[model samples]
Target: MGRPKTSASGASKRTEKDAERALNADSKSPTSNSKKRHATKETRSSKTATSPSTTSAPVVKRKRAQSEVPTADDVTSNKRSKTGRPSKDQTKSRSAKSRESEAPALPAAINEVPQDILTVFVFGTGENGELGLGPKKNEALRPVLNPFLDPSSPDAFHIVDFACGGMHTVVLSAKNQIITWGVNDNKALGRQTDWDGGLRDVDAESDDEDDTTLNPLESTPTEIPAKQFPPGTRFTQVAAGDSCSFALTDTGLVYGWGSFRDAQGNNRFGYDTDGNIIATQETPIHIRGLPKITQIVCGDNHTLALDTKGDIWAWGYNEQNQFGRHLFGRQQDSFVPSQVRVCRGNAKYIASGPYHSFAIDRQDNVWAWGANSYGQAGDPKSAGGDSAVLRAPVKIQPLCQKKVTTLAGGAHHSAAVTAGGQCFVWGRIDAGQLGVVFTPEQIQDENSIRCDDRGKPRICLRPTTVPNVEQAVDVACGTDHTLFINKSGAAYSSGFGFQGQLGLGSSDDVEVAALIKAKTVRDRCLIRTGAGGNGSIVADIAKRN
Candidate 1:
C-alpha cells in the first residue's frame, strides 16, 4: 500500500544527463537515422547510470542549463523516431481530447417524455408469482420488466403505470389505454359474462362435462374500451388492487370494474345491474357516483380516489379500515363511492400498500389509514398495536410536517420523498427491504433479533432516512425492496436480489445498500435496488453522447 521509492539520486541525475545528450544529438542530425541510433544509446546509458558498480562516490546534483533544453519541435521529432508507435500515455491523451471535442452539450432543462409515457411502478404479493413474469411463486426479489414490452417493434413501449393483485396484473398504456392480464378468479378481470355454450373454460379439465368452459379471455392482455367516459374522454391514470381495478379519466370521472358492494352488505350490481358478482367483464363501468376525480389507488381489498376538488373517497373491504371511513361494526360494503375526511385541504396523490393507504395533500402533507400491523400507517413508535381499525383517515404525524412530493407502497412497507429532496422509509424491513443502515445501533439490534414467525424484522414504524443518500428526487418500494432515483438520473436500489433483480448480475442479495452500475452504457449508468415479488427494478439512464 505504500508508495514505491523513487530511483536513487545519482541514477536520476545520470538519466537526465543522458536524455539531454540524446536530445542534442537528434536536433543536430535532423532526419539522419544515425542520429536516432545515438539517441537510443543515450537512453540505454541512462538506465545504467544508477548502477552501484558505475558509481563509487556521492555525486553533486546539477540542473541542466537552459541552453541545453531541447526545443519542442526537436523533442517531438526525436520522440517519434525513437518509438516506432505512439506511447500508451500519448494515445490516452489523444483519446481524451477527442472525447471532449465530441461531447454533447446538454440544455438547462432536459426534455422529458410526455405524461402519457410516464413509467409505472408495480409491486404486490409475488409469493404466488402474482408479478407474472418472475420464475418464483411468491415474493418477487425485485421489479422486473413486463414481458409485454415488444423490443422488436418500433412502436412497442413499456407500460407507463400498472397495478398488481394477488394473482392479476392491470396496466395503463402511454396512449391512455387499459390492459389487463393474469389470474381471473374472483371476477378480478373486469370483463366476465354469462354465456352457456358460448363460454369456453380456459382453465377447465379437457374431459369434465360440466366444466363450464369460458374462453381464455381473462388470461391475456385484453384492452378495455373507454365507453364509460364522456364521449371522447381520455384516460389519465389507472390502479389495480387484489380484486378490483380503478381508472381515472382526463375529464376527472372515475370508473371501476369487478364487484360493487354497498355499506348495507347489498350488492349493487345484483339490484341495479343485471350481472353476477362472480362474473367478470372485459369492459370498464363507471363508478356509481364519482366524477371530477384526479387520482385513484387501490389496496388489497379497498379503494381510494381523490377528486379534482381535493376531496377523498373510498370503498370496498373495510375490514382493516383500509377504506378510511368511520364504518365500525359494519360488515356491509360501500358499493357507491363515499367521502372520507382523513386530511383537510387539497389532495394531490394517493397510494396503497397491501392493507393500508396513503395520501398527499396539495401542501405535500401526508395522511394514512388502514392496517397498521407493520406500521404501514407511518407511526414509528405506535408499536402498530391499534385494535381500533381506523375507518377514517388519520394524519400521520411524522410525515405531516414534511412536504412529501411523492409516495410509494410495497406489500408491507411505505416510502415517501420530501420537497427538500430527502427520502423516508418505514414498514417491513424483513428481507432487507429497507435499505441497509450502517448505524451501530441498527446493526446491533439486527444481530440481537432472532428470525422467527413474526417474519425477520417487523416493518419500521418510524420514518428512517436511508443512509448515504442525498438529493433523491423519487422513491419507490417493492414488496421487499426499495429504489431511489437521484437528480443526476442515477438509480440506486437495495434489498432482495434473487434472480439478478438488483442488476448486480448475481443472485446473492444485498443485506446492506450498494451502488448498482450497469455495463450497457459507458456515459450513463443504471442501478436498480428493490424487489417486486418476482420482478426486478429497471433503471434506464440516458446514454452518454
Candidate 2:
C-alpha cells in the first residue's frame, strides 16, 4: 500500500497516523494505506512507533548502478552489461582482486569499532527485550550493570561492538562471532531459539524463588551458528534495523536475514519474482549478486551497502524514497539490492535515520534523502511537513562545510559529529530531540525553522551545534532522544524519556543536554553508546592498571 499524506502543521511521527487507520475500512492492504491518518500533532514516543513522518525539497535526480556502470535493468538481472560483463560468481571473484589495486582508501575512522573489552549496560524498559537485560529485570530506569555480558564474568563473550535496532540488539565478539538478542518475531535473531522443543524455564522471575521459572527465548544473547556462513567466513561487522539483521564478512560479502516491512507491514526479503516471495526469512541467507562490499547500514526498513568500487547499493522499503532513485510499480523491484544514484559521486561514509538516508562523499560533502516530514533529511526546504520528503539525495548545505566523521539519526531528527569534534543536531525540536537549546532571536527565520502557534520551535532545518556537548567522539539516537559520547568517556543525553531512555533515573523528558549520572554509570568510563526505539545502552570498562 502507498503511504498516508500528512499536513504541514508539523506533526512528524508516522505511528500516530497509522493508528488512525482502522482495519475494517482498510480490509485489504494497498500501498496507499499509509495515507489515512487523523492525528494533527506529533509525539516523540508511541507504542507502535516504527515508520518515520514525511516532509520536502525540490526534486533531485535519482542515480545508482549495480557496478561501475550498469543500467537499472542489468542490476535487476544481477549482471554488469547483460552481454559483456562476467557472471555473478565470477564478478565477485574479479572485483575482489581488482579492488585491492583500484578502490580508494577509506577515511581513518570509517566504521571503526571499539577494540577494548566491553562492560555492557542497558537502560529504559525492555518490554520487547530491547535492553537485552533478560526477563527478571527488564526495566532499568537508570543505566544498570549487565553482568551477563560483562567481561569480568566467567565465560564472558568479550563483546567489542554492537548495534541497536527498534527492539533488538546485535553484538560482535572478539572471536568474530555474531550474537543476537531481543525481538525475533520477524526472524531477526538469525537462528532458531526452539531447539529444546518447549520454552525453557529461565531466570526465575517470580519472587517465590524456587517456585518461579520463565525465560523468553529472545531475552538472552545467543550466537548464530558458524554453519550459517561458509567455512572461514570471518565476519567483521553486524547491523540491525526494526525487523532485519545483516553481517558483513571481511572478504566483502554480505549475509542477511529477517524481513523489511512496508507501510502496511508485509515486505519481501529475497531478490526474485512474486513466485519467490518469502514473508520472512527463517534463517540467515547469503545475499547474492553484489559487488565486493566493505560496509552496510540499516534504516527502519531499508538497507544501504557501499561496495569496494565506491558505488552505493540499496534495497528494501522505498515508499519514502530512501533509495534516491525512481521505483515504479510495486516494491517487488525494491527487494533486489541495486546501486543507488547518490549525489552523482562515490560516498566515503554513509548513515541512516529510521526513514531517511545520509552519505558523505570522499570530498567531505554530505547528502541526504528519503522521509523528511520532520526535516530529518537535513534539507531546510523540506522541514515544513509530511509532503516535504526528499525524493533524491541532495547535498546538505551546512554539513558540506564540516568534515563529518559520523552521524546518528532517529525517527525525525539527526545528529552529526565532525572531524573537528563538534556535534550538531537538527529536525523535530519541540520534543527536545535536539540536544541543544536556542533563543527566540536564534530561530526567527521562518522558512528554515518552523514554529508552533506559541512561537516555540518545531524544527531546525539546518545543522546546529549542541551547546554543552563538546569533543564528541560518537553519537547514538533512539526514536526521539539522543546519546552523545565525549572524548573524556562520559555520555550525555537529551529529549523524550517517558520510557527512561534518557538514563537519568527518571522518565521525565529533558530539553537541554544532561549528563547521564545514574548511580551505576557515575564515575564509570563509558566507551560507547547505542540507542533505538524507547531505550538506550552504554558500555564501560574498568581503569587499566
Candidate 3:
C-alpha cells in the first residue's frame, strides 16, 4: 500500500501569508493604507498608457481596485474578484508572487506545556546511568530529582516510555525520538562500532575493580544517530533483552539489533568469523515475515512480538522452552520468527521473564507457559510439582473472571493490574516477589505458602492479592522484585532490595508494597515504571500545580 499525498505545503504557505498580511494591515498609520491606494492608482494608469486600446476601461478598473483591501490569499491564489473581474496586469502580479514564495518544509515549534512545573524523580539503581542521572552516582535508595532530564535543564530530555534489558535501557521521548544508555556491548545503543569502543573499554575496567568504578554510562541520554531508521519513521515503543534491543515505529514496523545467541556472518556483530559468537549489531534490522507489530517483550534471550491480528509470534532462545516449542535437544535457538501454537481469542498484551512467557486475551484471561520452576505460570497443579517446564499456553484459573489491564514478569514471578486497580501477584516468593502476606489466613488455611528450611516465603501458586494497593494503573517487574504506580501517580515496590531496587530506605526486603516517597523539583508523581536485572526506574510526568 502507498501513502496518500499531503497538502501540508500549500496549507503552511497560506498560513504564513495570512499572518504577514495581518501584521501589515494592523498598522494604525493612515500613510500606509494611503500609499497602497496611491500605488494601485499608479499601476492602473501605467497599464492604460502601455495599452492604448484599454484606456477606456482604465476608469472602471480603478474604481474596483479601490473598493476593497486585497488579502494575501486573494493576491496569491489569483482568486476571482467578488464584484468585478480582475485586469490582466493584476493576474500577472499574483502569479509572479505565488512563484516567488514557497512553503517551508518544517513546521514551527509548538510549546505543549510549561516547563516551570515539569520534573522527573528517579529512584532505585544507576549502576550505569540507568537512573538518567550523572555517571558519578551509582545507587539511589530513595527518589531524587533528575536534573539532567529536567524540562528546565540544559539537556531537557522529556521521556514518554522506557524499556530495560539485562544491561541496557531504551527510552522514547515525547517528540518521537529515541535515546539509549547503560550497557552498549551489543551496540544496543544503535551507534557505530567506533563510537561504542570507548564506552566498552571503561565498562571492562569497572568489572575488574572491586571499588565502584564509574562505567562510562552515556550519563546523558544520546539520540540514535540518523540513518539507523528509515526516513519518516517515528518510533513509538522500544524493548530490550539481555544483549538485544527492539524498536517499534508509528507504522507498526519492528526493528531489532544485537545477539540473542550467536549471529551468522554479516548479520552478526563484533567478531567476523562464523564460529565465534557475535557480540553486537550496531544497526537495527527489520524483523521480516511478521504482521504489523503492536508490542514487543523480551526475556533474557527470547523475544515475543504481538501483532495487530491478536496473534503472538516468537523467536530466539528455546533451550528452556521459552518459545513454546520442543527442540528435542536438537537446537537451542531459532533464527526465524514463528507463531506460538495454542493461543485463543484476541491477544491484548504480552510479557516475558528470563525464561517464561505470558499473554492476556481479550476476555481478560491470563495464559502462561515456558519455565515454571517456582509456579510462576500461576498453575496450582504445578505448584511444587517435580517438572518445572510448561511447553504450551495454559489458562491460569486464579486470574479468570478478572478484567486484567496490564502485566509484568520478573525472573520467576508475575504481576497483573486489574481494571478495579487490584494488583495480583504469583510465583517465587523467597525474595518477597509475591508481595503478599504468607500467613495461613491469607491462603485459605491450605498452607500453600511454602517455605524453605531457612524460613523464607517460597512460592505462590495462585494469584494472590497485593494488599492495600488500589487504583493501580501500571506495573513492572525486575529479576526478583515488582513495582506499581497508582492513578494518583504514586509509586510502590516490593521484593529483593540488596541493590536498592525496591526503592525503600532499608536494605531489608519488604513482603508488601511500600510507597516510594522520593523528592522532585516540583510536585510530581510517578506515572510509569521499568525494571531490569537488579535495577528499577520510575518516570514522573509532571503535573500542573
Candidate 4:
C-alpha cells in the first residue's frame, strides 16, 4: 500500500474523500467478511459518560465501541521462556487454531479489522497540501491508517513504531523498514521516485488556472530512500520536529533530511560538522561526524541524541536554549552535534517539547530547560523575565525524589510517570492538559495556589500527582491535551477538548478529568484500551485470552 491517495479537491477535503475511498476500496477487496467480526466485538464492551466542563465550546457527541482489554499475563506470557517462567505454548496453539477456524469465510474490508489500531497518525498544518493527503489544508483530527500496511495480506508488513512532527510523519516497520509521508515542503520526504518529483514550486501567478495545475504535486505520497547509509540498511527509530527529520540506523548512525540552512544560509540547523543535510536527497543521508547513537529526538528546530554511554548532544535553533547547554546571553545555531553537559549521569531518556526540553537521569530524576513562558521549565519560583530562558538543564526540585520513569512533552506542557505508575503534570494548564480535573476542593485550592514570581497563578508548575489513578503503563501529550494508558489498557484523557482529542464523546471541556470508554464494550471488566494524538485522539486495546 502507498500513502493515502489525495482526492481531486486537495488536502483539506482529503479526510472525507479518504474515508470514502477506504470504504469503496474495502468493498472491492476480498476482506469484507472481517467487518462482522469488528461489529460483533463492539457489542460486548461497556461505555462511560463524562460530564463536560462549563468553559469549553459546544461539541457534537460521538458514539464509541468498547474494546477487549489485554492483561499483564498476555504480555508476559507472550515472551519466550529463557528462565523458569510459565510457558504459553498451550495458549499460543489455541489462538492459532482459533484464528485458523475463524479465517474470513468471505471477502472483507481492510478497515473492518476486529482489533482497533491505537497508533496516532498526525499531519501538521498542510496549508499547501504538504501533508500529501490532498488540498484540504488543515490538521487531520484522527489516525489515518497507513495504506501501505495492507491488512488483507497475511504477509503484509506491520508498522512497529511511528513519530510525527509539525508537518511530517515517519513509521518504522517490524522488518526494520522505514516509510514516511505527510509534508515534504522542505524535502522532508527523504527521497523521490518517478512519481515524486523534486519540490514542486506552486506558482501564485497561476492560481486561476485549471484544477490540474493548481496543485499538481499536492496529492501524491512519495517514498524517500536513505542513501547515505549502506544499501538496504534498516532504521531502528525515526523522529521529526517542526521542519526536519532524523533516523537512527541499527548501526548506531544518525541521518537527517529536510531544510538545512536557517532563514539565513550562513548556519543551517539539522546539519552536522561536515555539512551533511539532505536538502533534496529523496533518500536517507547519514549524519556525518558522530559516535554511535543510541537514540534521537527532535524539537521544533533542534535535535537531541543519546549515545550508548548516556551522553546527550544537541544542535539546531538555540533561541530558547532548547539545546540545554548554551548560556542565556550566548545562543546560536550548532551545525554540529555538541555534548549537553547537564545530562552527564546515566540518563535513561530525553524529550523535547515545542520550546522546552526534559530528561530523566539514572536515579529517575526529571530535569527541565529552555523557555518558561508558561512555566514549562517546571520551576514556578524561577523568574523568567519577559525573556529569561534557561540555556542549560535545571533540576525540577519537586520531582527529584519521585522516581520518575517515563516522560512526555507536549507543545507547552510536560508529564511524568512515577515508578509506582502515578502520573504528575506541570507547565501550561490553560487547556487543562495538566489533568487538573478541578473538583470543588481543588478549584478552591486553585484559588489559593500562590502565583509565581511573575505574579501569575502557579497552576502546579511543580510535579503535582493526578488523583485516583494507578497501574499506568504509557502516557502521551498533544499540543494541549494529555492521555494515559493503564496496565489494564483503559484510557483517560483531559485538556483541550475543542477537537475532541479527549475522546470523551464530545468536544466539551473537562476541567478536572474523565475516564473514557469505547462504545464497543458492554462489560467494562473485560475491556482494555490505549490512546494518543496528533491533532486528535487515537486509541487502541487488545482482548485478553
Ranking by TM-score: 2, 3, 4, 1
Question: Which tens-of-lDDT digit does each residue in 309-333 have in candidate 3?
Answer: 8898887766556777775443333
- Highest TM-score, which number? 2
Each model's Cα RMSD: 29.9, 14.4, 25.3, 17.0
TM-score result, candidate 3: 0.69
lDDT of 1 by residue, 59-137 (tens): 3221112122111111122243255787666777688778856776432321122242323223322322244432222
Measured by lDDT, the strongest candidate is 2
> Order the candidates by lDDT, highest first — what do you get?
2, 3, 4, 1
Q: Which stretches of candidate 4 lie over 4 Å from their true place?
A: 1-157, 193-223, 226-228, 260-267, 270-282, 327-333, 383-386, 439-458, 504-509, 516-545
Candidate 1: misplaced stretches above 4 Å? 1-147, 150-152, 155-159, 187-222, 225-231, 259-282, 328-332, 384-392, 442-459, 496-509, 516-533, 536-545
As a whole number from 0 to 100, the lDDT of residue 249 in candidate 3 is: 71
Instruction: lDDT for model 3, please.
Output: 0.62
TM-score of 1: 0.60
Can you tell me which runs of candidate 3 are displaced by over 4 Å? 1-120, 192-217, 261-279, 327-333, 385-387, 442-447, 453-456, 521-523, 543-545
Model 3 / residue 166 / CA error / Å: 1.7
lDDT of each: 0.51, 0.70, 0.62, 0.53
Q: CA shift at 149, candidate 3, in angstroms?
A: 2.3
- Compare candidates 2 and 3 on lDDT and give the better one: 2
